[model samples]
Target: RKARALLVASLLLHDFHLRFEQVRRAEVLALLRALGVPRVHEDFIFIIINFSCFEISFHPQSWVVTSLVIVI
Candidate 1:
């Protein structure tokens, strides 16, 4: 069915988006590890990852985003 095909495509797109985010988070944290930063808690890492994903959409270059990232 056409509807089913659309649903499958939507799901695949969502999965690809999640994978892209995971890649970005992995690269960011890997670079940090390479620079000798201490390992972060899983929850903290999640916050950073989520923030990184949204900051571009919402705040772009806002100081609020920068301050919150620093504070977290």
Candidate 2:
């Protein structure tokens, strides 16, 4: 259950990081790895490619607010 929760949190953080205007693809992968999101190193390149292909916006403030809400 803990691992599952960590996975979910990692995914959420990944999405949040992606929403940032200045976040680089490499940084995202690094964040995933730092968060221990399983297989990040092996899939880093592909993940970056896929994420970069998508049209997404990063809102840093929203991310912080949402994270605080989640914590509470």
Candidate 3:
């Protein structure tokens, strides 16, 4: 449960270092590796990082994903 949340947070976050972390997400990453689910997670992590570096979603050249934590 917490692992999944960490995975979600990883994609939603920009910097790799987190502000409030009580649980190490590495455990979840290990589980994913053991369960063969790391591919999807790694891919998304790469996408998030790529977007963060480029500040744009240019792969498909269609969608422009915004920040997950948006101000209303």
Candidate 4:
């Protein structure tokens, strides 16, 4: 289940990156660096997706925790 969530997040990250402007792109990279996420790590992509506010769809319905987990 975690693998599936990571996969979806990865794809969403890719799609989001394509729409990012140069200034925002630089800012994201900087934020990642500040957070200690290495550029080469695959998890950085997932982190980007999460930070971008892309909702992850989970099964059993119970996995949905958007209402409780505040991003900021």
Q: What is the lDDT of every predicted structure here? A: 0.38, 0.40, 0.35, 0.37
Q: Tell me the lDDT of model 2 at 28.
A: 53
Q: Taking the tens digit of each residue's C-alpha lDDT, what string does model 2 give over 15-68?
A: 454334454557655655686555544354455344443333345443221221
- For each of the candidates, the C-alpha root-mean-square deviation to the true structure, in angstroms, is 16.2, 8.8, 13.0, 12.2
Writing each residue's lDDT as its tens digit, candidate 4 over 11-69 gives 33322223222324455455456645545344544454456444434545222222111
- lDDT comparison, 1 vs 4, better candidate: 1
Residue 61's lDDT within candidate 1 is 32
Per-residue error at 16 for model 2, in Å? 7.8
* Whole-model lDDT, model 1: 0.38
Q: List candidate 4 segments past 4 Å from native.
A: 1-23, 40-72
lDDT of 1 by residue, 1-72 (tens): 231111111112121233323345565456446645566455655666665523322333322222113223
Task: Provide the global lDDT of candidate 2 against the true structure.
Answer: 0.40
lDDT at 15, model 4 = 25
Best by lDDT: 2
